[model samples]
Target: MEKFKSFLKRKDIEISAKRYLIDALGAMAQGLFCSLLIGTIINTFGTQFKIPFLTSPVAVIGGTEYTAGGIASAMSGPAMSIAIGYALKCPPLVLFSLTAAGFAANALGGAGGPLAVLFIAVISAELGKAVSKETRIDILVTPLVTVMAGILLSWLIAPPLGKAAMSVGSLIMWATELQPLLMGILVAVLTGMALTLPISSAAICAALGLTGLAGGAAVAGCCAQMVGFAVMSFKENKWGGLVSQGIGTSMLQMGNIIK
Candidate 1:
């Protein structure tokens, strides 16, 4: 019990801060690299392997919802979680904060915007770290509090903000017939550039409004491929290999699915 008590204590603040920064930066960089690599591969494949069945699946599953911002948000969780846990020796608290931040950030991003959610996550993590002490109760308390706060923030604050952003995005895309397709390609490239972002295809589809055969099919294809790629790249997952397969299969399926 005494030994356990010792574990709950915070380390030197300077050391803790340094370690936190390094871990966060490393995670962010890795996510960014993956996003760019995936984007490049998708663009190349789109041109070379234009087959509907093949590309459609990739597009549907491997769409560009996962942006760098999303990745940075996710990556920040583990770093902040562990740092708080070790520095304060309150595992539960750290874990809770991580969970809260992740959920809040993702939900916010999915609803429309990510910037506000990201800010909330960072602030929550920092606050959790400050309040935690070397105790099991503290661990639990930290995360619960953070999550609750995030949930409240997301529901009351993020939703309205996201709706407004979506409205703008919708207005921007509504101006043209081929706008959705162009938007899809642009988003796909961005997702490729930021591999850590989540399913962006849904937003694109919603924006496109299922107005025509081509637009609907395109959106569907993007969603399938994005999802498929995410599934394949669970951890340090190879983007190139999965993308190749995704492109081939998604395009092939598009022809059958579209009609």
Candidate 2:
């Protein structure tokens, strides 16, 4: 065990919950924001507000036309994979190869693509990192290993993971509909706390494919957590704290909340 730990350390692989769950998960959220979320927002505006250029089809893939936003949204899988690889500090070849793995995971994972990408990307990046620069044929060896591992893993597990996540999300949404008062409070409180933690609540929601009542409750909880902290600390923190915690992030007030 000690020898293995030393090997990992020597290779720059730090095995810790903070590295995988916190740092990588946090980075995953940013990737989602830049790709899926922003694309959806732009598409929404284009559709609702009747913006001409925003709605204009820019490209086509697999016989389907895509607007600017659609192109970005379609790349969510690669974006998430590369983001996680970047967070893990995978080498250049390993990182670039993650795009393929990420695409496979996201495409195969279906609705739960984000979670699949998270799991697969972490494993692939680490595996690639372990083998990185170990051979004279580093360029060829690195990408081959990373891409194969990613695609195989994605094919084997991404769909099942996606289905499982979507099922869980369906259950939650169903339960919320059946018992609005109870489930609403339950989701709100848990999601609110999740928002303040180092974990990525957005990734959680995406993995579960949360929507309707459950989605609304989660959003409400997050907003309340952020705004509530800002309001509570208004006197002590002033506007600076308000903008930081409220608009910026409720995670900023996590230490204060714990205190």
Candidate 3:
């Protein structure tokens, strides 16, 4: 028992914040940039903005014209998992294992898919990592354990978490509608902060099915963070900085801003 206790107290199991940032958040960012940001930009500018020939749907698949956003949305699940696995420092074999986990978690989570993938992927990675070097056939062992853990956890936990996330979003949306001035302020501040944080406000909004006042408020908040920072830092960064920070991502300077 004492030996087990000592083993439990070892630092190897302890996941530090820096590690989390490097592994988890970093992965999320990559996924978001590739799937969400790039996709959104392509969809929005191409479909909505009038830029002569450029403003047309990028491609046609399955009798449907697909904009950048549409393609990105479809690929979000796998992209998120792949980037996340890379960040988690997963071996090549285990990296693909996380991809399987990501699909299950995202699918089961419904609207709040990314968040579900986030939780499941991180846990599964750790579990897989623990047994990674234990077996001679690491290729077989790591992926089997990781994918199984991820799928099981997704089945057991994702539905409830997704529902909870949706519920919270609904409450906020309703509140925003009922009391635009008050709830708007609250949602704007909170969701805006969420946009800048490591999480995905778009996924949350979609999960919550937020629209009308709440959706508007969410957009406002995100714009405030993105454009606000870009404009504010214009003096220091110049036009290039404005384009990068504003159009590219306000979170670019998150660490520096925090400091």
Using all chains and alpha carbons, the TM-scores for the candidates as numbered come to 0.42, 0.75, 0.74
lDDT of 2: 0.80
Residue 203 miss distance in model 1 (angstroms): 3.1
Clashes of 3: 0
Candidate 1 residue runs with Cα over 4 Å from true position: 1-92, 104-110, 113-117, 134-137, 164-168, 175-199, 211-259
* Model 2 lDDT per residue over 39-98, tens place: 877898899999988899998788999998998888878988888899899899999999
The collision pairs in model 3 are none
Once fitted onto the true fold, the runs of candidate 3 whose alpha carbons sit more than 4 angstroms away are 1-14, 21-23, 49-68, 177-180, 197-200, 203-215, 229-245, 248-259
Best by lDDT: 2
Q: Score each candidate by Cα lDDT.
A: 0.44, 0.80, 0.72
Q: How many backbone clashes does candidate 2 have?
A: 0
Best prediction by TM-score: 2
Candidate 1 lDDT over 24-88, as tens digits, reads: 33332233234433444554555576744324433222464433234433343233233333433
Every candidate's CA RMSD: 13.2, 5.0, 4.5
Name the lDDT of candidate 1. Answer: 0.44
